[model samples]
Target: MSPSNGIQTVALAGVGNIGSPLAFEFLENGLTLSILTRDTSKADLKQYAEKGANLVQVDYSSEAQLTQALRGIDVVVSTLPSGSDDQEKNLAKAAKQAGVKLFVKSEWGLDYDAPNMEPVNPMIASKMQLRVELKEVGPPIFVVSNGLFATLAFSSFLGSLDAATRKAVINGNSAQKFSLTAFEDVARFTRLAITRLPIPPAGSSRVLRVQGFAASFDDLIATAEQVGGNKFEVAHKSYESVADKQLEPSLEGLIAWLLASLSDGRGLLPQDKLTHDEVGFKPSVDIRKTVETVLKA
Candidate 1:
């Protein structure tokens, strides 16, 4: 059935981190949503079901199941994580066969289309592979290349120093500025694209790059210091140093490459009027603001 506004059903694959928040946004807007999950036993979905979501348990690894789940859906928003490129490829194929309209690939980190930026982890690999496969899909698909989630910079995963009382092991100082987008805002943007973006002409590839805020690593530490109301110990370690200490080659290699690239400014978006105009997002949180929120939480 054709939606009142041209697009009707939206299916979101994967409901972790950004996906969870994004799904909430869609539900809040009173849209018909179909979500794919591996774990029905996970309690986090209780609220989602109460909010009127059709949460389906499907194996991304199985093409038949994905195809069945995608039937009758008009739009597909992939919040699926890395290492699922093959599944995504299969889904895109199914979406095409099912007459899907818009398929958004989950490439929400650094801009893969950037001149110097390179894919480092398995996640990026899966994303890139899906992009290539999307070309052959009968329907139109788009990629949203949003820079690092601002939250990542503050979280331990990104190396927020976990020091006893004095020294924390952090990758960089507070001075290095980077851009970030809030989860809620990402949801709004996704909705806008689904509901408002003008369709691209017959045959064209569309890419939307979004930025939230730009600040340095030092900025984050300073914010933390202000919130904690006390000076914390600091330890500076090079990405190479972190790699040397890691025992696992895969883990170490991935971290080393990411660290070096981040340090080298490979993922840094170009600072220009045209670039900003093209990306079209003004983020809500600055470094200090983000730190305060984290500290309070």
Candidate 2:
């Protein structure tokens, strides 16, 4: 830890959808910020640099470069896209070599601890592999199991509610509940957790399951209808039926797998309790407001 603030420098890797927002949250919370990206020419780098983030460009495949970039960092947050499991493992190895205090893995959603749960896609399988690798590494780890991102829930990304079509394809029973957390909320909670949570002893870490809201497919459709002032044409599909149809090769297959998993309660976090409350933080985003914002967008 840096002597000045008690908590030393923080570094973020792969500043994409989740990473970018998390970077801003860390910066806003008054932490020394550094960003690692393979490409320096990305336009967002300029914005991050302008906001006082130290931008370090490095080849993800080069362990030497990664070790050098992570040197002297207190915490490392990886928001790398799914399927980059090898890269995440390599980065973890580099972080451990560089003596990083904490490494927050790239698990932003789902309860990977679920028993007998199989990966619905290659990306998910890679994430599971990273978890296994981290357990053998040196740095203290933190995993945030924040169910489905609210942004994806309202968008077509999850294949649940289609905003453009004003249609919802509910899988399994519409009454089955699941969790949803906004990108901003996840970033906020992450900032708090990384900076405030006590560092566990070596070979020990915590998985914090948090969410902004919990709702069923029927609840989501109802929220959409209420927000849009129009009833959406709802269609019910069995989880197996939808999963089989989306098995064709394409990105949609991945989406279908996620949707079906959520519908079947495979990857979703438990909704019976609030992890954020247990940790003394409150999430303010509600399902109705989230739907309205998405509809307005």
Candidate 3:
């Protein structure tokens, strides 16, 4: 099938943070949707069935099982966590066997295409391996790369900001820029791409990039202060001090590399590359708004 053929069905694998909202968006649009899950007994999974989804229980480890479940799916979106590259690779093989017209890789962040790009965060290794394996594979794929999820712009997990202590840490200067998008907006834009994008014959490589708004680390700190109506103790560490070594496979380590990339120019989209406007989405939340909501929560 091609982009002009229109989408009749969409199957989403993995329903955590990004997956849950994406499932709801597809169902809300009244599409024929299938949700993949390992367990059918969860009450949380039942909600989508109530919302008119056909939940298929399948072992992601088995390519045959995933292929069978994906038999009639026009699109397969892998929202599996970044660490699950092996499963995603199997899913890709299955997608091809099942003749899935389009496979949407969970390409939500970073400039993976950057020259000299290292797996600063170990989780990114999954994406890197998938690309090397499938860059020329069939069942033309789709990727939507929006910088940081706005909800995570000031994530305490990154140790960049401690909301409780009101302390902000920076690597290098605060002027390093990166992008952020609200999670719901990501769902909306993914839906748009389903229609606006074409499924090229297998062997295609491309990425669709978008950003809610471009802001710097300093912008986040200031936004936090304004949103919370409290001042913060801020610190700046040299880039060498921040990213001189391999990051451990922890949330804080991954976040540190991500922040360091911003300063070194590996964390953001290029000037002419942003396509959110072309895809027709204006993010509902900006830096200030997301910080306000997150801080309030």
Candidate 4:
């Protein structure tokens, strides 16, 4: 790892799927890591505490609790999911008050920064709004514009693919290029962002557009079929119709909206100028490997 980069203690606001891998990355890098959550009884939270993380439970509604947890933290990262805007706002306030040097926004999906990439629904809108509010409320906001979590497309809940049925579906024409990032790669890139690059302070934010690889859902299906020794029949959906059904709110609804957002090619990262080369993050997994993982699971 590169020498400190002026960051000493790193604190995370939540430790879900994204946060879990990210926290481990920080810890493995020898950075001082703290995990902030409201629940200490969770088995996962307990594991972090065992792994040398300062796992502190706090009531997000209480400013004192938030402030106390943030004291002496150099960077405060929100890995909470999209809906927790209020929690993120409070965390940013606490980070600022505690003199944290940077506040990282919890955006681990999509190139929503791309042109014409409007929010398809309230969830995506909330994520975008949180980034804006964080700029006004916290230290420098660090955003990684990773196009999509590679695992999302293969998830059973997203319903894009069925291993048993050998069938697959996608938003867009199934050939619109978009970036896909693995969770561990996201963590590693994020670690690089904080430790190996110049992070801005409050009033000015930093955005890095990075990806594991760029591929279409068709590419993913091909990869999966190759890895699994089977072929997948494919179907396509439009972004407009898929976005409409997601207003009811469910896992299926959310993925439908996410898939729809990709229809117009807004899902893609700029092919000419991806930030991975500048940031120096060589992804550990690509589309084929990511697909292999999902097919196995």
lDDT tens digits by residue: candidate 2, 179-237: 88888888888887776677867776678888888888788888888778899998887
Q: After superposition, how far is residue 209 of candidate 4 from its true place, in Å?
A: 1.3
Better of 1 and 2 by lDDT: 2
Tens-place lDDT per residue, model 1, 1-297, is 122447767889878888888788888886788888877667988888889989888887776787788888878888766666677777777777776788888777776667766535554555676686776763677677666776676556666544224335655333455557677666766776676665554334577766667666665566678777867677677655643433333655555555555555654666552133333445566666766666665
> What's the alpha carbon RMSD for model 3?
2.6
Reference-based TM-score, model 2: 0.90
lDDT of 3 at 142: 78
lDDT of 3 by residue, 1-297 (tens): 233457779989989888998999888886789998898889999889999999899898999999999998998888888677778888888889998888888767766775646645776765766876865553687788887787775676566777778888887868877777888888888887886666666777668777778888888888888778899999888887668643767665676678777777776677587766766666777777888777777
Q: How many clashing residue pairs, candidate 2? A: 0
Model 4 C-alpha lDDT per residue in residues 105-175, reported as the tens digit of each score: 88777766667776556677778777888788788888888888888777776677776678987755777
Model 2 stretches with alpha carbons more than 4 Å out: 1-5, 116-122, 243-253, 271-274
TM-scores across all candidates?
0.84, 0.90, 0.91, 0.92
lDDT for model 2, please: 0.79
- Preferred candidate (TM-score higher): 1 or 2: 2
lDDT of 1 at 287: 67
In model 4, the number of clashes is 1
Clashing pairs for predicted structure model 2, backbone only: none
